[model samples]
Target chain A: MIAITIQQGRLFDPANQLDVITDLHINHGRIIAIGEAPADFTASKVIDAKDMLVIPGLIDLSTRLGEPGLEHFTTIARETKAAVAGGITSLCAMPDTDPVNDTFAVTELIQRRARQAETAYVLPVGALTKGLKGEALSEMVAMHREGCVAFSQANQPVVNTQTLFNAFDYAATHKLLVMMRPIDAYLGKDGVAHRGAISSALGLPDIPSAAETLALARLLLLAEETGVRLHLSQISTARAVEMIHDAQARGLPVTADVAIHNLHLTEFDVADFASFMHVQPPLRSQRDRDALRAGVKAGVISAICSDHTPLMHDDKLLPFPESVPGISGLESLLPLLLALVREHILTLEQAIKAVTHQPASLLGINRGSLQVGAPADIAIVDLETDWLFNRRQLMSAGDNTPFHKWPFTGKVHTTLFQGRVVHQPKLA
Target chain B: MFGYPGLSSPSLQLNEAGKLKHLLTLEGLKPHHIQDILDRADGFINTDTRQIHKQPLLKGKTIVNLFFEASTRTRTTFEIAEKSLGADVINLNVATSATKKGESLLDTIYNLEAMQADMFVVRHAKSGAAHFFAHHVAPHVHVLNAGDGRHAHPTQALLDAYTIRHFKGADFSQLRVAIVGDILHSRVARSQIQVLNLLETEEIRLVGPKTLLPHDASAMGAHCFTDIEAGLKDVDVVITLRMQNERMSSARLPSEQEYFETYGITEERLKLAMPDAIVMHPGPINRGVEIASTVADGPQSVILDQVTFGIAVRMSVMAGIMQT
Candidate 1:
């Protein structure tokens, strides 16, 4: 393959602590050199990124591709294209799919589809328990060997504490990373939103913060005993963040990520009983949102993921409680993070690091860097470009985002996957 | 308008001209809109005493009682209201309906629509079931919520308001009304509070145990009190709510006797209110649980009168919405 050179862009590589205006040379799908290219290097293509900010491709810790079962809502090909448009180069696939991703065959199916799409790298997370029924442990060792990145039950906590302990023990012995989304199923009790004044007034059932913190406390204690590398997914409550902070302070091998929606939206957004705002660990109070932002700044929260679970079109058309949970978040991820930057909650460097190096490090991946010989995965972003995010213009079949028609200030100019332009806006 | 719940049923309940398309909730009903219903109900109250009890207003209209959640009192009252107005009423047992065969709620509504039903009287266990039907049903067909899960019971509220206006006069701003019993699980309590606020009542007090009271009662414009005596002090009306037996398992009440001792209205407790204070209950009353038998059957008891007013109030709402 011929070489490509990206010229005169402000490159920010958080993993190497490098931020400067530079040119990068890529050959054979690897970053060959930085700044001045070698004398023997010949550039077949050059991208003019003079006024753009180039950063390491974003890594999402949790995203639902809906390939095996829910392809009508979104297939791997459709969602990955949207992910690349949002500057995401890699995403961790959730295990909560049709038939569940508990077996090696199911994990392999996801990998095959992701390879066929060739947009973003997909790391399948195998179900912690068989069929995700929470009754018995799945073949974690075999699935891990099949290239499953992590083991998780997702939002479905194991049926009993003993089952969770057994799963933890098995995962510990296998030296595998287990992603736990802390929620006490009994406490959640079929609730669709946060239990507060909004829920009370709306006459809708609420899922209180206790649902998250209570389950998180038990999982952290078990992780401590089992000595498993535990990663908490989508921590939304302030109390949960504080507990994770304390666990990390006491030297537990623990890492936690907050979904981008939790940082920007709250329970008040669901006042109209808008089905699109119905997410698990339901959008919390404004106080919780503030604390989550603080957790990200304090480094207590190591990563920010999309938590992109897209639903069928009619699934969210029903009344509030009966509607499904989750949002189509891949396309809105970077715009929301830039909104955080615009609000001064995070600097541009911190925002980039949270989506790139922090998540990449948590997943133990080698791609979230711009060092020599690293994969040429990069995203060119225009910080000042304003755009309206209408769902009709988006690529995902789900089109179920709550932020449809919202005005956004940042836009992804181009995305590169292994030295190839996977997504770029067509000039008007 | 300030403390309105985030969910606006206005678009579903009101037509484009802002008329009552469906009797879903009393939340957004204007004072004039409520007064019109009360005034129209005044014309129906004396119909039984007349030679002919039938009216030609809704003569050929077909009303369907689509009760997904069973209610003997609400169903009977709505049926009587429809029959007295010379309309045909069909009561469908939803459990044995096509819904049992895994058909969706909308499919049931569509079947009813195909049958040319003019209105749907919906009593569902879900909070927004009535609103859901109202939004999706045929535009010409109206919907009336009998009671929905902890949401609203508009007819019950209308009847309660009529009873209060009958004895205490239409100038409700001078009256103090206390609604006592399980406020958390009672759809009646939520609806009553909305109508009471719309009537501009002074000092609406909600009396219940902490566990039985809603966390957002005060936000709905009521002074919440755990002490029944404090809530009843000098109130012009004392409204007691029926305590369903299932509340014990729901963990909202400790025991039947404990709830009776704490929040139940007694003859002596009635003395805490004004001398001529009228007691009310949305019936099928557990005699000794939510109120004493003496207080429920006494001269001050307007519980039976509420049943009498319920038919007239429902007639008023049905006629108002079904008007061509």
Candidate 2:
């Protein structure tokens, strides 16, 4: 492997509490040194990162690469490429694929495809139940051995409380992390948006905050009883954040993440019936969005994820309620985080940490840092450049972002994965 | 042109020139635009001759009645309006169409557009279905929303307004109108509120059980009252909404008998309003559930007039959009 030297960059690694202008040396796909190279070091290549911000590559907690099942909408290869372009070096691929990631074969298949793509690292979240039917248990312990990062139901709820309890108890016994997007299936049934004045006026079916708070209460209690390491995915409501805050304060092993979209958008975004704004655990109220931002600031919400579920153009061309939910979020993640910084919703360091270090810590990964021994997964960003987000710039197969045409500051100038230049867009 | 109060995107119902391209919702429509529609409806029905003269306003235009929901009354009124305007009409009950066979909505729309559909009277189960159709249809094609989930029924509101105009005069400033029952689920109430507000109706009271009312009922520009008698008191107009049997199963209400005992419109309750005050309903009324049979069939009831005016109101909307 060629030795690479990234010279004169402002490095920002929140995990290491390092923010300084320095040179980073990478040899044999690992960060060999920082500030100064060794006497014998001879760089095969050099990257001039002058007037740029170098940070650890983002680690997304939840991203759906629609391969092995819904590849027609998007593929693992396409999404990973898009993720890399967004400076996301590792993506925790969801388990809601065809032949659901309940088996070793499916888990292995996803990893193999991701490897072939040679982009971001794909961490498989094994399904909590067989076929994601929520009725029978899957081989969590066995799948964990096959490199499943954690187990999740991935939007499907285990309707039977006994089945859910047993699954939690089993996961706890095996010491596997269980990720749940808490929503009471009955309460949120047939709902397409948040229950609020806007949804009521628009006449869209509404999912109440009680659906999340009630379900979160159940999960918190189950996590307490079973002693399971619980991670709540896509916490949307203020009450849910309050519950998680209380849970963490009480010393129940629980962590939560809010999607990047929820931090910025609210139910008002869906008022025009723009199908792109239709997302599951649907874009909540402005108060809820503010609460989530506060949750991120207060550290009750430890990480922010893309919650990137890409769908075909036709999938979103229907009516709001009938349209498929989710945003093709990888490319928008960095810019939107930068937006928070610009708006003073979060400090730059806090924004970067939520994506990189915080998510990495939540997943128990050794990456998302620029320490000497760590893999050279880094993003060189031009913080001063402003660009309009458009479909022509979208690398993902799904052009389903609501942020299209939005003005965004901060652009990824270059991305390095394992010390190799994976994505370096030419200056326009 | 006034921007729609709650719509996040620019109203698709209007063109760049601010002309009526589609009649999707009344939320963004100006009072003059509404007055123009009501005025056009009056021209269709000659008061002196007591006849609804069929106009050739949409002589060669082809209108498609694309109903995804089952609504015999709404569809029939739209069909009559389309035919009355001398336009060829095709009724596509999508429940029995290619949609049931798994075809996408756009695919269905494209297929209809290919057949040269000039206008579509869309009644869909989903709230934004009409807007969805309006967005995807050909530039020349106009969309008229008959009803969508619990969103808006602009034509129904227009016809209801027309009925009120005929009996109570066009001046809505003095009208203390009471809209009783199911404000949460009634698309009619949503559109009625907007139309009433646009026409500057004084004191629009929403009377319903707390469970049947939207959480932000007051934000919808109406005084919400749980007490039906208090809501009906000295009101110039009473609009009773149907209490669906489905609400009973959904735990919204205990029983029909209990609902009738509390919120149901009766002759006794009718006395609380002005003696000559009119009663209206977007019917297929649940005879004894939301109203007593006597009140529904009484001289004060303009339930049948709403249906008659609905045809004219729809004809006016169809002609208005096509001419634009």
Candidate 3:
């Protein structure tokens, strides 16, 4: 009944106790065992993975694939290919699409497209309002039944406190995880970038660290009061980490994730006003980046996400603050995160877990763990391989990243989505 | 070419994103570049002290203050700083000139360009008139918008922020700043709120008679406060505007005496602020109409200092923009 098999690989399987060295058996698209298998273990084919690192495929809890409505940024084909390039097997897309994902029809359409793309799976988050207009609640129950992963209105916040509290209560009653972007909209109005010495000196648009942290504080309190499961996306500022830490310590229903861009870079990158680095929350200060690293090291932010809203080059390639809100995360997610491992900030295992198992737990997906009975959706990565990133080679329809031509390591050599190689780049 | 220590030569920026670029008004910009111009003017200032001054980095570039708006305070002070910066000076109120041609702005601009104008310091009563010139002129030309038709008076607002930062310190996340009077017609208050919100200043309030303050004031990131005493309550800085006589017929707001009695800044009304809170006015104050003389000339008022900083700040912006 089974077909695929892999041999001789340094396995860092946290879910099983197999550390650094082992073999995995695959049969009928499931991991049959780890360690050297007996002679009777039959397979149609066996590939040697003598010096590779096999980890559970990564999942981005709150990802942005600008498609369906805004296909100019990225279509499903390019985004899924970008996801596989970064070793991400699944991505939970934001609900803030055109016409907004407020109903069952939108969520199902995303899944249907994912199946056709033949790459990463897309779990859609239905909008919490009639049209994400923040006026009234959409049917969380019916959408959840239609395979909506959670009720999410990601980047746009529920401005009125009453409207937000109501969304939380309805989500709690329906046992749905509600994801929030967490910015005090009134304070965030003229703010085009994170406020700091650079922003002060330039006389450019600025948003204080308080704009983000304050809304997080309000959401944490609301979660404590309403008993709703809350997920905070793109925790950018150091102050936000402290607030979320306190929320988690008090056992509030708040789980948070950090964007790779926020953790690895800061406003200094935008000093030349390189439109590529001109992102929303406009890259934090260096001190904030250090704090975020320490936050991840200390486990305050339990997951690492891409916050990957793809914008076409026409939207980017402008002056510093006027460029769009995000960088293409799916393509660079692995290399950038691996840079953290190479920098000694995170162990390779720790790095893999953040993008993989940790986000899996946050998204409540059954994937992202390499257990004996789990589906054999493994990413075979060559940890020591080096490659150059050409913007032209990127699969995402969006070609907007500051690291357009940077050299990178830790490339995914072969990716098995469901025990079949879906993506394979020529080995150097 | 002009030179200042640490600042580069007076470089003309063909691209809107170039450093030291002037963003006086958006007239000649490529539609591809208009939003880029608005995007650059978004930075906040941090000045240390109760009386804010300006950065001295633009010291060598000349900034002529060519204001036709009859005002001694803003004019003389900017002239003072141009001299301080070791730059040549000229203050021409072109109100007597051919500006009334409905003369295309560049005709006036070309006459000045012939005079080796590095920076054309301009002020007109019409909104977007400066932007019109900024766009029509060559990239080598730079314009300073002193005050334009209810469009923007950016430098004034910069000085207000500098003064606020000097007095209130770096955190505006919780401080309440009330900008009262003639909101619909005053570009000074309008620009001030834009800069304040960009700095993420909390509790910014706009107070005026309903006829003076437009319904859209709230979108500008300020609570539209109608009651004077209530709006001024517990505020840190209160900026009052001089009543524009030209708008009297159309304003249809309160009469001068009634306005002073209703929305005017008074010593009694001053009690509603945090003690030691400073008062500001972009003057020729409407002496007894929009504000009582006692508070206009009160102990806490930094009205004159605001004037001094205005010249220095305008020179800084003029020189910096000219350099770009």
Note the DockQ of each predicted structure. Answer: 0.35, 0.58, 0.04
lDDT of each residue in A171-228, candidate 2, tens digit only: 9998899999998979968899898878777777889999999899999999999999
**How many clashes (backbone atoms < 3 Å, residues ≥3 apart in a chain or on different chains) does model 2 have?**
0
The sequence of per-residue lDDT tens digits that candidate 1 reaches over residues A1-428 is: 66899999889898898889989999998899999999999999999888888888899999999879987556999889989999999999999989799999999999999999999889999999998889989999999999898999987888689989989998999899999999896885768778776666667777888989999999999999999899999999999889999999999989999999999999888866677888987998899999999999999998999999877756766666677788889999999999999999998878888999888888888888888898898999988898899988877777889899889997999999988899998989
Better of 1 and 3 by DockQ: 1
| Highest DockQ against the true fold, candidate | 2
TM-score, B chain alone, candidates in order = 0.95, 0.95, 0.81
Instruction: Please write out the lDDT profile of model 3 over residues A259-349, one tens digit for every residue.
Output: 8888888865653445667666568888899998888888888788887877765465333444466777787888888889998998776
Error of 1 at B199 (Å): 2.5
For each of the candidates, give the backbone clash count: 0, 0, 11
Interface RMSD of each: 3.4, 2.8, 12.5
Question: How close is each model in CA RMSD to the real structure?
Answer: 3.1, 1.9, 12.2
Using TM-score as the yardstick, the better of models 2 and 3 is 2
Q: What docking tier does model 3 reach?
A: incorrect
Q: lDDT for every model?
A: 0.86, 0.89, 0.72
**If both were scored by DockQ, which would come out higher, candidate 2 or candidate 3?**
2
Instruction: Candidate 1: list runs displaced more than 4 Å.
Output: A71-74, A426-428, B1-12, B15-18, B47-55, B58-63, B83-91, B96-103, B110-118, B138-141, B322-324
Residue lDDT tens for model 2, B169-194: 99999999999999989899999998
